[model samples]
Target: MLFRLALAMGRTLQELRATLTYAEFQEWCLYYQIEPWGEDRADLRAGIVASTIANYAGKLRAEGSDPALPADFMPYLERPEPADPSDDRHLTDDELAAWADAAIFGIPPE
Candidate 1:
């Protein structure tokens, strides 16, 4: 997946790895219609849902009708705040373990 992303972005894998933060990588994945491996399922699902709605809106506009989507209808279009890498606070071992279990086992972590 990383190789494909690198090719699509016209960047070498080393450069992509060196330059992109995780969030930026995800944004690029979405732009290139490539799914990021190991992305949270809920986030992927939300993207799918939003894409569907946007497509439907496009169809309606093509038919000479206004869908009148709300200003905030597509929240995914907004850029999220960049993560602060220098912050010392981070997820605990237990929280990381729980997230891994949730991703692998399809169970929500408590």
Candidate 2:
């Protein structure tokens, strides 16, 4: 979502970091299938985070910059962050394993 945030909101990485709350930032990382910090995060939160990141990354790569994106997407659109459409998402086995470990019953090493 960093790239998307940069495209739509025109914010730098640092700016984007500052914009998102603790939870939002974590969610962003999780959305990308990147390793989240700890076991503290709930399964649902991690899933949402992973999805949001994945979706945003896909959007940025596929669509490039958003011409219609406002200068400050957060202000214009209460929550500029996109939803994670994981229904049809293709996650790698390693990724699925981590999510499963954290989300599902058994835990797997990230």
Candidate 3:
């Protein structure tokens, strides 16, 4: 749901990149009541942050600057797999977003 919400927010993938600090993002997630909070959630945020850092690093490299990812960040380079579109049970974007919003804000879709 976070993935879908982020994608819906903007065009560039960088926009979805975890720009906030882990602590800040975690707080936001908690406020939204994102589920399964613990190391798994922490790891998700970390991956987002690391991916953003890597994106910038790549851009910098292209611009003739040297950048390197730390060992911890390296492991997170591979992103989590998106849901398979062929799955019969997967909700459409509108449905998913509506559900997510209702879950987070207690406001159902019109």
The superposed Cα distance between candidate 1 and the true structure at residue 22, in angstroms, equals 0.4
Q: Could you arrange the candidates by lDDT from highest to lowest? A: 1, 3, 2
Sort the candidates on TM-score, descending order: 1, 3, 2
The local distance difference test score of each candidate is 0.63, 0.54, 0.59
lDDT of 1 by residue, 1-110 (tens): 57766866788999989998999867765654433443343456666677668867677566765553433243443343768989788899999998776544444678
Candidate 2 deviant stretches above 4 angstroms: 26-110
TM-score of each: 0.28, 0.23, 0.27
What local lDDT does model 3 show for residue 28? Answer: 56
Give lDDT for model 1.
0.63
Model 1: residue 39 alpha-carbon error in angstroms:
22
**Between prediction 2 and prediction 3, which has the larger lDDT?**
3
- Weakest 10 consecutive residues, lDDT, candidate 2? 69-78
Q: Which stretches of candidate 3 lie over 4 Å from their true place?
A: 1-34, 61-110
Q: Write the per-residue lDDT of candidate 3 for residues 25-68, one digit (tens) a residue.
A: 56656754745444345666776688678867688466765454
Question: Where does candidate 1 stray beyond 4 Å?
Answer: 34-110
